[model samples]
Target: MIDLTSIYHRAADNYCYLFDEETLHIRIRTKRDNVLEIVLLYGDQYEIVDHQWITSLQPLEKIGSDSLFDYWQVAIKAEHKRIRYGFILKNTEQEMTLTEKGFFSFIPEDSGFFFCFPYMHKSDVFSSPDWVQQTIWYQIFPERFRNGDPLLNPAHTVEWGQEEPSLTNFFGGDFQGIIDSLDYLQDLGINGIYLTPIFLANSNHKYDTIDYFTIDPQFGNINLLKKLVEECHNRGIRVMLDAVFNHCSVEFLPFQDVLDKGEKSLYKDWFHIHKFPLKDGDTINYETFGFYEYMPKLNTANEEVKQYLLKAAAYWIAECQIDGWRLDVANEIDHQFWRDFRTTVKAIKPDLFILGEVWHDSVSWLRGDQFDSVMNYPFLHKSLQFFSYDIISAHQFTEDLTTILHSYSDNINQVLFNILGSHDTPRVLNECRFRKERVRLLFTFLFTFPGTPCIYYGDEIGLDGGNDPGCRKCMPWQEEQQDLELKDYIKTLISIRKETSLLTSKGTLYFLPAVNNCLAYYKQKDNQVVFVLINNSDTEIDYVLPFSLSGKKINLLLTQQEYAAESDELSVTLAPYESNILSFYI
Candidate 1:
């Protein structure tokens, strides 16, 4: 008789299997102190009876306080379908592969089992009909925005001299500030605001979440968030909060309970632990990548933890009525957790915008299961690498850009989030060595290029900063008196981007050969066509159009400059940092 239920469990170094009395449920159990590692299920036995053992990574040292973990899950519904799988572990000198004699086998190449988690239904989600298909988004870090509320200033605990220039430190900035600055953001022509983590966090940056249910008091109360949402909606702006699900603060109730109770904590199952790091009842395990022990990582592998955070996210969406989320450090967490997390958030708020923070290509996330978008760090990194690193050749630079865009699947490519500068990096102006022209050329490319464009606060006014605290500097309201031209130029770019469908539309492109160091590309969408050219070289170079010219020619919408295209190739020139956009009607 083929059993209908089966489970495969792997301990710190062993495997356990369990079968239901009715043979309809298979249970796999493995425990370390108080934590459980893997619990998987199978619908039928005959479906996947013959399978070999594969590979598995050595269990990570319990970074939190618990020893339990659930890395992946498999659920088969059909009665006769069988899937083979196994586990292989290798670290340094010791390597071993083992097969369990229970239910369906785990296979590394099989993606079907990986996508088993629940997903937000398409209809209920808030994605535009073609949201990800054709989108150019702009991200706004709220605190540095306009200060709308004088009541919501951050309380300074440490002096500037005492404050370590590290991410662990916090600077007070809030939601009221975002509302007061809507006009400034609107001037930049962004469709959405992917604000950083705004949940009730203990720190100023808000990554160390204290309470998922409430908005941070420093950032303003929940009421302030509602007002911001209403105002943003009033102006056709979509708002997405930052979701830092990978961990919680040490002050969080679950983690606190673990610390208080030691080994007998009821919430001990919520974290991963091999052996308690505490020697004399002192909390030894601080967190994943933290200098201090206060910020603890949440065990996403736990179902209750998953459900709790998902519900918290849903509550905010329903109560506050925000659009979606920007997941923090998405790559470090388990893929299944995000899959289920995405499903839960979408189920609560369809059309919800989900973006992830990954420093490189996240195509694996876009496989129709996890995130709607990811911070286009890959593009941002490459662009900065080209200008700041100067190690890459022009050919290599262009090729890298092309490769990134081409790498994404169709659906993922549409909602790609690109940025010039963000809260985490040096402002683009400084990254370009304070050269206004190179900056201008970059702006031309940024606004013209595909994917959503995110502008870190103060980038428009040419704010200069090197890294973290510097990047998070106060807005240059006072300096605008001297840099009005740069401000106006950004406003113009925003205006043109909003008005032109060709610039915003999603379509294929043809790269025109470089004129000297000038590179150009044509963005065509049906009857609308736009030609963008940027000259980064020291001297002006004449550029000739490569496409057919049998059409009505017009001036560039942003600069209001006109050019005639008589032959298939037309002569156009750009000076240092000079860029132009020529529109044509076919």
Candidate 2:
């Protein structure tokens, strides 16, 4: 047997957590080459008599393996809110028991051999808003959504859809415009709206914040915002506003004071000024977000700055009753600030959703102390690489996705904000090179995947753009200018997601093995199973179902095709660039 002294740990990730007072998630890790399987021997900590402990042996699934170790996981309920657990490791030829003390040939009678979870408390449980699981979010770039009140349009504002978007351009989109298009969003089946920075800022994008307390004049006044929030809530839609606390626009009053009175400014500590005198040009002495001169990084470490930003976050929820805050540049800020931010926000509104804009692995921020969820950019990248770019084969795609699912706890993965295209990336249709079939397959995977899927504004109607400025095109109100077919397809996908409980956020995902360029997976919840198949290759292929479907009724969700399994094996032919979602009721 492999050496048991190579490593030792209880649970490295946030895998050990109390979902509630009784349910506990526990996980352990061992050397990748050491153990073939592990069995968790656990029971109530006090269930012992006459030098023997009563315990239950439960097998641990090998969730994932990295270069050094293999991660095994399990979730159990401690009826008494206390647990004593130990691990039994096995190889092909040998078996050994592992405990808090060390490895042994047999289970030890002493209680010290087991690791103890004294008690599971309700207060320590990590949870997000209940409404998040059923939500289908629609992200709106406010300036590009609509133009309801042209009177409030900026002096330099151009015609709504006539002008191409530039770095600095406005089309007079406002809250009233959003209010006017409530029916459109509601009919499209969106239950949540994530609006990018609507606070007062000089730029049309509004990330460069000039004021946080007041709404942008171009967007509307506080009354208009209240009305917007009320309308959205009335329609059962939750509104999440963007919070850019990492930095502020150079035009901000505090930054202006620092620029005018270099050393004498009382607000000098508010920002990170490298030198006494601040000069402009290519050379930047102080820290900024990606070296941009106009957007100076805020000194979030300071207590004063923390209080100021916390107040701004509290102001929106307390005054307008906004549902949540989507933090901008969330990773650059300190963790303590976010922990405090969560405390401040959750105290006022307990169920408020907090989403962080993190592009990479965000396990650190999602430990239940900081943000509720983060933007799933890793999923998007891997998806595009497999479906749109065809850089990876079907097997590699599944392997990469499995690694992602195993990286986080089950609870964190359920509420993850999954996105295909956003304000930051190229439009999904553009990424697919305007192929409608590829777009369909992409959305099919997105809606069926286990998370809350987000739709960027105008993507439903076949809006195509390269990147940032190009992706921020004005919403087309006219029926002739829109792709009605694609819009209807997306509407149907949302309807399926809402109507089907298993497809929404909680479903067991299984990646079926495929031989060629075709990909398939099964999403099973209870007795219902949804089998999704996508043909990425150019040639038609006859694919066989991976599992036995004998005596079960099969109905394809998208095409409405029906079939009966005569034998244990069932085969179907998939056209090039085609997709199918088969539902089997057993």
Candidate 3:
């Protein structure tokens, strides 16, 4: 047995290692160590593979102080399978064991290493496409968005002892509804639309999926969806449908059949069943998620079920021409399924983006598998939690924002959807007591900060609601009662975001300063440099510009307001929740 207890060391400067059955690639951290060669050994006989050097590390940083090195990566094919493997330094004639780690770490057979790191084994189970990195998505709850076609509305009364509902209960929003509003979306500069699950489901919110293949009758049939996709494609917009693979409704055909006939049912193997409730037919004794009772969890471990889901996903991409998917409760489902699903989906279309619904750190999902990005709830949650005390100081906000940025992985940090509030939470304007100035600043940060920004529907018109059902209210089309100032402010911001290359194009973010209840940050890409400053203090505060960033600080937006930068200090007075954009050449 390979000794699992030993902490084998690579060279002190070696930072990266990639090994499959055949080859082992090692990367040196510093440029000085780039000349070293690697040797793999087994049973006193050694196999040597020459190192092919890639470019040196772009920016050099001291690691501890022992060694200096550079990167060396090579692809190799091994002669025989070796259990006990170690590497030797070519120049120094020194050897030490290299234990496996990371997403591809191999497990020792006897020690139950697989059980200990079950999730890690499940980490590389999927491969998401690269386009998800560039998507600026907008999530819309169909019931609340708009009502286009009235004919597709389900009858108020159902047949054979079915529950009946009024038209108000079902707002009659359909596929055509979204189709009619493409111009509005295009004008707003949204690239993608992430509609909630439109599958055949019972609830107004389609979390309870009844059929995997069919579109909900209330939301029009499959044909309508295809048409909608075509129209959206014509307008240069991509559509991403929500996939609730975690659970199915009790009324779902499979679940209902299982409930009707205990073990004898054909779909018995699909769910995790032990016993059913005696009073209300047979209730399956299966493990379910924490959300609600009606939503029964699917057995993704079953290969047949896995294939069916993959087929359905492929059907949407191939048949409906969807550009991506927003996976619901992705963490709760089987890891292998995600891996297989990603592979299968990518095989169908390499550009299909998969966004997972992970509320916390979703690094494992975003690492070139399963998902390209997550909902970014961590950013919104922390930001809102800090500002819930009725006021957010600029320094506190900046610190909190920077902490979130650094915590995330490089891929997710840049592509994350920075949303103020979604259908799941209270509206920001309502929570901030209808303070339009603060709302304006928050939206400004959302559009300017790292990652793709999303705007919750009706937020631009100052819609206020506290929680779910209320927060997910219908679109207020009453033009006379709208917040014109807030709407105009949002329009201005949106226009600027679409027109300005610095705001739209991604760049390296650098923190400038956070002093006297004011914060400053800069984004640089190519020749464009945009400096964002936010003042959260009650009284007017003067900002002293950094000496290094002096000369030609032109006010990009507020041109009427005069500011001066001379002799190392740029003094400008800022009102409460006032923000400014200072454009200059680097």
Which candidate's lDDT is highest?
Answer: 2
lDDT of 2 by residue, 152-256 (tens): 999989999888898988899999999999999999999999999998899989999998888898988999999999999999999999999999999999999
lDDT of 3 by residue, 209-293 (tens): 9888999987888898999889888977888899988888888887778778877778777777656541244443675657466
Candidate rank order under lDDT: 2, 3, 1
Candidate 3 residue-wise lDDT at 519: 67
Task: Name the candidate, 1 or 2, with the larger lDDT value.
Answer: 2
TM-score of each: 0.73, 0.93, 0.75
- Report the lDDT of model 2 for residue 334: 94
Give every collision pair in model 2.
Answer: none
Candidate numbers, best TM-score first, in rank order: 2, 3, 1
User: Is 1 or 2 the stronger prediction by TM-score?
Assistant: 2
lDDT of 1 by residue, 354-413 (tens): 788888867567655787778777887777776555666555566566556545532344
lDDT of each: 0.62, 0.86, 0.63
State the TM-score for model 2: 0.93
Instruction: Identify the leading candidate in terms of TM-score.
Output: 2
